[model samples]
Structures are given as C-alpha cells and as structure tokens.
Target: MEWDLKVIDELPDYMKMAFLILYNFTNEMVFNDEMKRGDVPTSIQCYMHDTGISEDEAREHIKHLISESWKEMNNENGDHNSSFSKEFVHVCKNLGRASQFIYQYGDGHASQNTLSKDRIFKIIINPFPYKL
Candidate 1:
C-alpha cells in the first residue's frame, strides 16, 4: 500500500503525512546505496507532490525521521553509520514499487503531476544499463 494512504489511515488523521514521505525518502536513499547523507530538497518536492503535502511539512518529517534514526545510529561519542530501520526500509520498498507503478502507468491520474523530476533527470543523464 502507498505509505501516505497507509499512514493516514493507520495513524491519527491529524498526524503529519510528511513522516511517511521522510521515512520512504531516507529508506530509499540508503537502500539504493546513494552517497547523500540526508534527504534532498528535490526528493522532498517529489514526495510532497506525490502525496499532496507541503514542503515545510516534508522537511520537518524528514528531520524527524533522520533525527530519531541518528540517535540510534550514533554512539556515545557521536559516531554514525550507513544504517536505517529495517521495518521502515521494508515499508519504503513497497512504497517505491507502488509509486513506480503509478508513475509508469498513471494515465494522467492523480500522480501524473506528482512524478519525480529529479529522478527523471538522473535517468536521462545515466540511462539504465540494460533494457527490460
């Protein structure tokens, strides 16, 4: 299920959906082996556009996720790692698949305008190695 819909339904409606976006963003970046230490503004925009949320909310949510995770990843002396929550990663993988499907065959539906432009640029600049 989409993280936004799931989080919205599972958590209290008043709860911010940005948390879901941040969770997915951080999980995706780490899982995909990206070097970026934190979520990017472009990624935030994509998540917000996809879920119909606000930019500030998205940034706040990402900060919340990263801050909490940092607490666990850091040692007493304040060290870090290329680590993340497994449960959140699983949720993000599922969310990524759902989002990909929507983008590939959304047919100009709700997600048409919500597609990630940054990702599109990356794809264009560095096309995938193989044809599927």
Candidate 2:
C-alpha cells in the first residue's frame, strides 16, 4: 500500500509547515540512519519560507529547539535509574552516539559515499577468509 501525506494536510494551516519539518527531520534521523550536516541551514530556510520569518530569526529558533532536544537526550542518558534495564539504556545511549558518529562528517550511512560505506563493507559484506 502507498503511504500518503493527507494526514499532514489535515492539520491546521498554521501548524502544517512546522509539523512537516519535524516529520522530515525525524525521518532522516531515524530511517535514513544519517543526517546531512547542512540540516540546520535547510531547516532554517524551510522555516523561514514557511513562516515568512527572517533568516536570522528562523535560525535562532531552530537552533534553540535543537538545543532543547539535546538537553532532553542528555536527561534521558543521565545516571538516574529508572524501570528500564541498564543494558537497554546503554543501547539507547550508544545508538545516539552512533548517529552522531555517522553524521559527523556527512550523510554517510544513507548516501553510502563516506567512510561508513567502507566500514559497512568490511564488517558485513566481506568476512574473514578462514572459517571459525
């Protein structure tokens, strides 16, 4: 079955653009497994185009929102123990770190055009010549 953007269109006009940007960003972060380093600028431009805000204002707001998200991630990774298993928490933290590493230079994983490609090839595509 084909997916649709109709649900997005159903949103109120004032919120549709912001929601679209968020949805795109989240999809890139989760499904793409990589993010272009230019995401912030792109997001700022998107917001400015959508809201008629100045570039500077859009950039400031986007950066502040990103900073807030980082703070939330940090809080989740903090030493406070919760009902979750320590291993699960560690995995979540490592996933965040791995995402940062993958996107450190560019959209390595999604584009398959960076050092990530080489690493993936070595680990998954090619195996040791000798059997265990």
Candidate 3:
C-alpha cells in the first residue's frame, strides 16, 4: 500500500511509531482478508501484545490519534497543522482489534453501556490539539 502521509514526520516520536505499526497491520489485514478467517488475530491486538503495552494503553493511543485526525480533516482547507485524528481512526478501524470490537458491538451494544456517554462524547468531540 502506498502511503500518502503529509504530516507523519510532524507526529510525536512515539505516535509516529505507533501509527506506522498500525498502518502496516491495517494493510496486511486488508490484503490478507484475515478478518474473514475464523480466529485470526487482528494486527492492532497483535501489535499491543508484541510491544507489551497494556490493552488500555493501546486503545487509548488509537483513540487519541483518531480524534486528532478528525479534528484536522474537519478544519478549514489549507490547515496543514490540523490534527490527523481521523486518519488514525481510519487506520485503527481498518486494522486495530479495539476498532474491530467496537464495530462488532455497534452503538447498541450493552458492553459499551458501562461507559458514560457524556464522558465519551467529550473525548470524541474534543481531542487535545497537541500532544504533550
């Protein structure tokens, strides 16, 4: 898959690495069609397990990137500084296990009922503009 990333180098070091891994996994999974294979592991989950990041950390990182990308894409044209949060979300939903789970559950899933919609709404709508 050819990457046309214009702002990758601008990403924070850790985030850049994470995004690369996520992108690679997304490509591999899509090309291999592994999701159709029963019991096949998603790339995002495999990456977290291999990297030894807690599940929560992996999920948080993926979500953060998605939020940032969305913010950037929705901003006015020529805003190169816009966050690439949507791109991140796109990558994760395409390859990450957490995203897979979310899709599987959908909006009406009881599993998500434990989370407060108010809190999640805030996170989804308001991503930190810059990584600290």
Q: Local distance difference test, per candidate?
A: 0.44, 0.51, 0.47
Give the Cα-based TM-score of candidate 1 against the true structure.
0.27
For model 3, residues 10-117, the per-residue Cα lDDT tens digits are 865334544554554343324223344443454446657888897567656656655565444334233245465656544543443343333332222223443434
Sorted on lDDT, best first, the list reads 2, 3, 1
lDDT of 2 at 24: 38
lDDT-better candidate, 1 vs 2: 2
Instruction: Say which prediction, candidate 2 or candidate 3, comes out ahead on TM-score.
Output: 2
Candidate 3 similarity to native, TM-score: 0.31
**What lDDT tens digits, residue by residue, belong to model 1 across residues 28-70?**
3332223243433455566677888876787676567655543
Report per-prediction Cα RMSD to one decimal.
13.5, 9.2, 13.0
TM-score for every candidate vs. truth? 0.27, 0.44, 0.31
**Residue pairs whose backbone atoms clash in candidate 1:** none
- Alpha-carbon runs more than 4 Å astray in model 2: 1-45, 55-57, 77-83, 109-132
For model 2 the local lDDT of residue 20 reads 44
